[model samples]
Target: MKRIFKLRSELVFSAAISAIIAIIFAIILKEFILGSFLNNSKNTTEYVHDDVIAAIEYQLKNMNINDSNKVQKYMDKENSMLYLISIVHKDGKVIASNNKEIKSIDANEVVDGKKTFKFLNDNRKNLVKITRCDYLKDGCYLYYIYVGYGKLENENIVGIMTGIIFIIIFFLIIWKRISYISEIKSTVRSIAKGNLYERVPLKYKNELRELSEDINYMTSEMEKEDKKRSEFLTNISHDLRTPLTTILGYINMIKNGKYVSKDELNSYVDIMNKKSLYLKNILDDFFQYSKLSSKDIVLEKQKIELNELARQIVQEEEDEFIKNNLTLSINLMQEFIYIYVDPNLFLRAVNNLLSNALKYSKHNTSVEFNISKEKYNNKFYAIISASNIPEEPITDDEIENFFERLYKKDLSRQKEGSGLGLSIVKDIIKLHSGFVKTYKENNRLFFKIYMDIKF
Candidate 1:
């Protein structure tokens, strides 16, 4: 609600500023430009007035009443706009007027001093100036000067109407924007309270639309992460309980003296030890995953030969493959290819991949480890892949989920190992600014890593 009020306040402020500027501009235009034009018009009408008055005076002195045509002709020429002249007697009788509509002059209106009055004629308001001619001392001559000011009045009406229209338009824009921002505020509040499904309505274009899209994207990613975290808890609990239950059961059996022979007792101890070791491995992987997921992780990176690294990791894992009844093969590029990486973390990622191969490979199947150079977009990268035939065929979707935390293949959940191996590998590779992928070709499931090669 406060946000909405703030928006409204800002809009009102802007409108107020605009209105002030418009009013100032109107004042400047009226006082400087329009005032100058009106002044010139008044001056020109005054010149015409003096000339008409001089002609009437000259005629009254020299010509007779029958010779009033000369005065009427002069008045006719001047009466074309805003000038009406008349010759009136003291008894309210008009001898000649340029306007034929003036049948008689009002004797009461014939005053001594110059006086201004409003005159209405032909649906227009005019200013009238009354003058009594002093040349005829018997109060014989009087003139009415009319100047039409209706155009100026119309201009004032237009300016007022324009100001009213501007005010209405500004308010309409403010109302629309306030309504839109209110919608966004409401939706954001709902999302803050954990309603990630709420999304802002996409109205309008450009900047507002992009903001809505970004908010929706952020909410969607948060929802996915929430779901993954829930699943990680559930799966870790189940995996940890399995090994713990096995070790406890063996220990209880030995405590009750249930073994029939001494060899059987030794066998129980061996199985318990193996189960304990499995639990330790799971705990270790969990710790590593936790450390890698933290934001403050630091890496000590150094340049290392990629081919030599792969060969060494594979050789270390060769005996484990043989013990699992699997054959191991290694093919490395003869030319040396070096990449910058943290040796410990990179070794952990490679070890996890090889261990995963041993756990899932079909009996007596050949596990292939290789390092080769590849080019993409004019940049060289070293490709390290470990491939083997799985005991069960893995689908494309399952392959994609392999790098997600606590995700395990349904076929291999009964196998002995933590499901975090591939996830940890993914995290380690991300720290090195590289990527990992899995694909199956020719019945061999392949896990590949791509690292940028720098000289």
Candidate 2:
């Protein structure tokens, strides 16, 4: 059931199986051929030479072979189209023959009473073999057998068997590949039909395994994105509806004449205005974040002094920090670090960090804004960091997903503003080819943006 094996091993296995089947087939066919030849002749020797040699050796043990005519007559009697029989006399004279092509043979070349020789017959070489026999007083009854056709036929049989082996291996491998490809196509089709959980079977340990794993990873990511999109729509709708409901309720109170004093009516109007502004802020953050998150988000990048930009942002938001009873401190390095960035997007990213710090920091505590050039992994980066002590303690898990869209750490979910500010900051920084990270040290949370300054 575990179908994981190397391609090389599979091919070897196919070849092994093909060889076994071909060998069996060759043996069966050889027997059938020898059977047909034997059945055509009148000789009844039972042992079948299912090989290249269809020999019929004559045993003249008691018969007198000194009569050349008698030997010739006997040779002529046993001659068949399947094989030729000739008697080689001791004096190297080929006395009797069925074919007149061979005139004589060297007696010394007949070693141990058997020899294989080649001669030109019809402009082609024909192999002839002498079968083993005894030396008589007149001459030895050498069975000069023409074995060319039998040998060629045997070789052809072997060639046919080898061809069959390769053909079987080719088709077996091709069929497996086609079946696996079909399975992959089917799984992909299912995934395309919104079955994001469907996966290819990983029963094979081959190149396809890597491909399957990659596709499975892609589908998992798409599933996560789909779930996240659904959640985003639900949360945004709720956030939008909450403020609209409050504003509508205030208008209804005024319409129904529920308020007795003008001051109370004015108070309702102020609250409505504040809710409407908060709603607008939420919508703006959502749209901006969505735009930056899109693939088409383009940045108009230019070289600027990063330290100067940090100072300008701090100065712009200094009044807000003071009004919120928080001290804003700037710590910039002496050297002016310059980096390529989209100025508006970069400012937005820095403003979100400052806003988050202002929103969370304990009153009367100082928010530290630092800008410096740093070297990490042999690359120079411009680092902008802000550190502040939060009004409420935060856990490591909360900080881990701090930049995720609509992920609010406030357990009561009563916090003002949509939770997309930090997420937008992350997207803007990414568009500029930078990264943001937040960590806690000395009981103060630190949010840092690292942008490559070397370029």
Candidate 3:
């Protein structure tokens, strides 16, 4: 709610600033530029007034025409704007006005010291000026000019209406856009509150639209990563607790003298030892995974004979096969296949595959460890395939899941192993810019390693 309020505040602030600027600009146009044009029009009209006054005075003095009709016609012939000319007596009597529609005013309006050259009435309905004739005095005749301008009034009405319409539209758009920003703020707040499934819908375009897309993508990835972390913690607690519980139970029984004989006590000790070993192995694998997961992991690389490494790993794991009553068979190309690799990391991956082959290989069946070289994409790679006929039925999905952390093909964990082995193998191979593949061929599950051979 606070975030929404903040967004609204910012939006309103920006809009207010824009509105103020627009008003200032409009006021400048109205007060300075447009006002100056109106003043210029008024000045030109006054010039016409002076010319008419001069002509009338000339007629009264030289032509000596006392007839008001002749004087009105004389002013009309010289006036192109058709201004209303009125001749009046000083005691407030109008002699001649061209149109009665023109607003009336006192004859003293244009007298030298009296409110000279102003509008006739309070409503600004007419521009009027009165002049006293000097040629005929005996209660002197007063001449008045009244200009009723419709164009200026119409322009003012149009300007006022346009300003009102512009203000209404600007505020309407601001209201709509502020509502959209509030929607974004609410979505972000939901995600922060752990509602990971919430998503933003695309409504409008611009930088804000692109920002929404980027935010959605980030949250989606964060959700997946958070889920993985939760699962890892759950698995770790269970895996670590099971072994510790077994060791604790056996220690308690031995301390309480629960073993009936020497053999029973010896068996209890053996079981405790195995449980402790299991706990240690789990911790060690987790530590290795944590180390490799860091971005700063650097491998110590060297050139090694790929065939020798594979043969050596097989020899090392021969005892595990013997314990399980499974045989180990190797098929090598007999060529010196030297490749550059981090020997320690490579051996760990090789050991994982060999151990997995022995663990699932059926008794009285043979697990094949083969090493050969292949060329693809104009580069040579040392290919190692560990093939075994498994004791259990493995599907395509299980093969895919094998490399996922804590995934157990045999949920019972009878193999006495953590599920991180194959996943660690995958991470190590990927770090070395290599690839791994698992497939079924000829009723055999084969794990293949493709490592680039340095020229």
RMSD of each candidate relative to the true structure: 11.8, 9.2, 11.1
Model 1 whole-model lDDT (C-alpha atoms): 0.76
Which prediction has more favorable TM-score, 2 or 3?
2
TM-score, one value per model: 0.66, 0.68, 0.63
Query: Model 2 residue 280 lDDT?
Result: 84
lDDT of each: 0.76, 0.74, 0.71
Model 3: lDDT to the true structure: 0.71
| Residue runs of model 3 more than 4 Å from their true location after superposition | 1-182, 202-221, 260-262, 412-415
Give model 2's TM-score versus the native structure. Answer: 0.68
Cα deviation of 262, candidate 2, in Å: 3.3
lDDT of 1 by residue, 1-455 (tens): 11223444666676887677667766665565445544445443445446556666675566564456775675566565556677777666777788867868677756554444333444432233333333244555656665555224535644885597567656665666667778888988899999998898876554555677888999998888888788777767877898789888988999999899999999999998988888889899999998998868899999999888877887788898899999989998889899999999999998899999998899989999989987767977799889999998788999889998777786446786667899999999999999898899989999999899868
Which residue segments of model 1 deviate by more than 4 Å? 1-164, 171-177
TM-score of 3: 0.63
When sorted by lDDT, best at the front, the candidate numbers are 1, 2, 3
lDDT of 2 by residue, 1-455 (tens): 54566777776787777677777776777667545543432221111222322333434434466666776676666656655555667656776666657677667644444434332253232232323333434545555454433233444665687677667765775587668879999999999999988988874677678678888899998898888788778777888899899999999999999999999999999999999998988888977987876789778888999778877888899999999999999998888788888888888889989999988899999999999877777987899999999999989999998998777777466777688889998888888788988999978999999998844
